[model samples]
Target: MTFDDPAVADELILPNFNYLGYLAQGSNVAENRINGAFARLLTPTLAFTIDSSWVHQNWPTGRTSGFDKTNIGLKYEAFRDSRHEALVSVALAWGVGHSGADAPDTIQPGIFFGRGFGDLPDSVSWLRPFAITGSVIDEVPIGSGGMALAPNATTGRFDTVLSPAVETLHWGFSMQYSSLYLTKRFDGGPPKDEPLNQFVPLVEFRFDSPRGQNTAATANPGFAYVAVTWQVAAEAIIPLNRAGGTGPGFRAQLLLFLDDLMPALFGKPLLSDRPAHSQIAW
Candidate 1:
């Protein structure tokens, strides 16, 4: 449901698919993306994540596709307050460049946080089911940038060109309303096999601002069906500005919690005496 979460106990694997339609130079371009991520707890408050994606584009002139980039990162839970259902984490990630079809490598350092309103007074019990999660990552280029051959207007021939990569700020947040919280606090309990109580509806806002470039913003409205060991989610992407996109798009994701599904293998930290924990609210 969100690009990043503060919880370090989410030991899972997720695969997602996305579609985007945009206008480039007055021509409509469609992009399809397949992405996957794997996360595992190395300690009670530390985790490692690996992710990558492949993108295919259909343009007016032709079609092209390639693996975007690969990212590996470590997340450390810096703070947690169970009474307030709050969490915070610090993360550092490396984007592998030349190994893939993307651009220059990057060093991404980020902060992630999550907070639930359950601590609100009983007078506002209705808001107890709401939660907010956000993240801010700074992507700093590792080298000069990538190079490509482009036609030189003056020379009337192909010439080697340098594509300068600037630092980019990726930030986003998700607002969620969990029926699971409602059921647990007010309904006593939902009927068995009733999936409605396990649903979480959320709206996410994403913005990418690169130095010296117009910021791109997008809104994703979606819902997730969470179970004991797995989750399924879908969202519709809405461009919030001209720089975002020209048309709406969609995405779907499937996440599996290996810790819960295979406790013997994934239930404990790989190199810690502390026991593994689960942060799933439902």
Candidate 2:
């Protein structure tokens, strides 16, 4: 089945996040995922993130398999002026799988670059809030026990992703194209001999209150943002030359500042008089 099918497209989200989970089904396989991640702003210009996820799948024949993955990364803003800003980031990811699946666990390293357009008013800015990002990743096999089973499985893969995104006060959208080319070692050698390559497109909507300024000239904290996302994908597994079917997917999420959550979690009233930094969907 192709990942582009409505069934598959519904499983991915863009502008990504710190935590996520999903479930999907196709004619040939059923998949489930669970993930947790954290992102922290180190300075006005630097940020760091850590993420981990678990994925499990069941084939039509009743065969079940799964993998666990962890990733860490840092991002730095390279240039910022009144009209635009550019940033770069790099990440390292590790993976391990159970069952006899040759999904050979591996370490993948990648780097990404992004640029954003600024200089528009908040109310109408969503129309031109554009950003473009791209990344190249390398995967290297690891561990011993699993290797003995899929001895012919390829050692790893080299992949890349290109994504472009835009957002407004009430909506956001993005498209990502990812390609994975496996090496001709282990068992499957080369892109023509393996199941690889995918394309995904995502759309989202955010609901929030109006923006407000802070006193003493402090930075605007912005209002909380709540959003829902929908995605579609098309995937290919070579060698067999058989086209996989496609699927649809969806996600619902919310983001609030730590300060907002603190009072709510402690059963205190949300400060009623604070100047809103951004619109928030109540």
After superposition, which runs of candidate 2 have C-alpha atoms over 4 Å from their true positions? Answer: 1-27, 41-48, 63-67, 73-82, 93-105, 118-130, 142-245, 251-282
Q: Per-residue lDDT of 56-125 in model 1, one digit per residue for the tens?
A: 8775555667787799999999988877888889999999986566479999999999998877999998
State candidate 2's TM-score.
0.40
| lDDT: worst 10-residue window of model 2 | 1-10
Candidate 1: regions farther than 4 A off: 23-27, 148-161, 184-194, 280-282
lDDT of 2 by residue, 61-98 (tens): 34343444455554444433323434444555554443
| Candidate with best TM-score | 1
For each candidate, what TM-score against the reference?
0.89, 0.40
Q: Which whole-number lDDT from 0 to 100 does residue 212 have in model 2?
A: 35
User: Which candidate wins on lDDT?
Assistant: 1
